[model samples]
Target: MSLIAAASFFGWLVGPLAGGYLAQYGAAMAFQVAAVAVFLCMIFVATVIKETHKVSNEQSFLSLFKSNNSLTLLSHPNILNLFVLQFFSVLV
Candidate 1:
């Protein structure tokens, strides 16, 4: 799973350089190819991917970012405090 994730990220990372070169060569099919490649990625995720956690429910995007779920013992509180303090310090 980790390897697959890494490879997917690597492909995304290099995609623009490859596509730009292909477009300069006037292959014209370059954008279509990239779109198809993305579609194929969706298929791969649907069929081959499994949840990493043993038990996990998918969360909504807004809820994921907005949740107070980060309040915590190991790391969250002071980190958030420092972050908020930085924001105020910058504004002041």
Candidate 2:
């Protein structure tokens, strides 16, 4: 957990510097580089990452979006409070 936090800290620290350097070429070049990096990361995750959770084959993907599931989560007091807070915050 500490290693992950440290890596995330360094990533935030260096990202702007790297982006600024890349921006010297052009704003479009910087965006293109970012897009390519995201694509490569996606590819790496798809190929190299192992799934830890065992998903039931019987469950259809659409079932995951059922209203009951959403309502159940919102039934929790803290989560519901946070949800309302977020909703009002956006309007402000």
Candidate 3:
């Protein structure tokens, strides 16, 4: 499952190169084909993909942010100060 998810990202990256090549034919055809392919992929996932989480059988929107293990990540005090500085820099 992890491998397939990783490959899907790679596929997304590669797909546009093909689509860009196709676009040289016509902008309309390129978009139309991409839309059709995306719809087909949705159909495939709906029909074939299954919930395979080994830890728990929880399936919902909560499943999306499904980070299981929680630990005290803020053990270092400097990291929090760094985060605040980073956020403030982005404000401008």
Candidate 4:
């Protein structure tokens, strides 16, 4: 968790520096560069990464939302209480 937090913090810190460097060229060029970088990353992930988890034939991903299962889960007392707390916290 700490590693994730640190990485996220550093990413936020460095992102502006990268943008600032790119902005010296032009806003349009900066946007194009960012777009190309994202495209390259997507391609790399799609080609290089393999899925490890095998899904059972019987269990579909939509099983969680089938019937009233999703509603039933959300309507639990503990979940309702958490929702209420979150609402109040955000309201404040």
**Which of 2 and 4 is ahead in lDDT?**
2
- Scored by Cα lDDT, where does model 3 land? 0.77
By lDDT, the best candidate is 2
Better of 3 and 4 by lDDT: 4
What global local distance difference test value does model 4 have? 0.80
| Residue 81 C-alpha lDDT in model 3 | 72
Best by TM-score: 4
Sorted on TM-score, highest at the top, how do the candidates line up?
4, 2, 1, 3
RMSD of each: 5.5, 3.9, 6.1, 3.5
Provide the TM-score for each candidate, comma-separated.
0.50, 0.56, 0.48, 0.64
Q: In candidate 1, residue 39 scores what lDDT?
A: 97
Q: What range of 10 consecutive residues in model 3 has the weakest lDDT sum?
A: 66-75
| Model 2 root mean square deviation, Cα atoms | 3.9
Measured with C-alpha atoms, the lDDT of residue 35 in candidate 1 is: 86
Give the per-residue lDDT of model 3 (tens digit) for 1-92: 99989989988997889788998889888888888988999999988998676656655665545543232334557876777788899998
Q: Which runs in model 1 stand beyond 4 Å of their true positions?
A: 1-9, 25-28, 51-76, 85-92
Alpha-carbon local distance difference test for all models = 0.79, 0.85, 0.77, 0.80
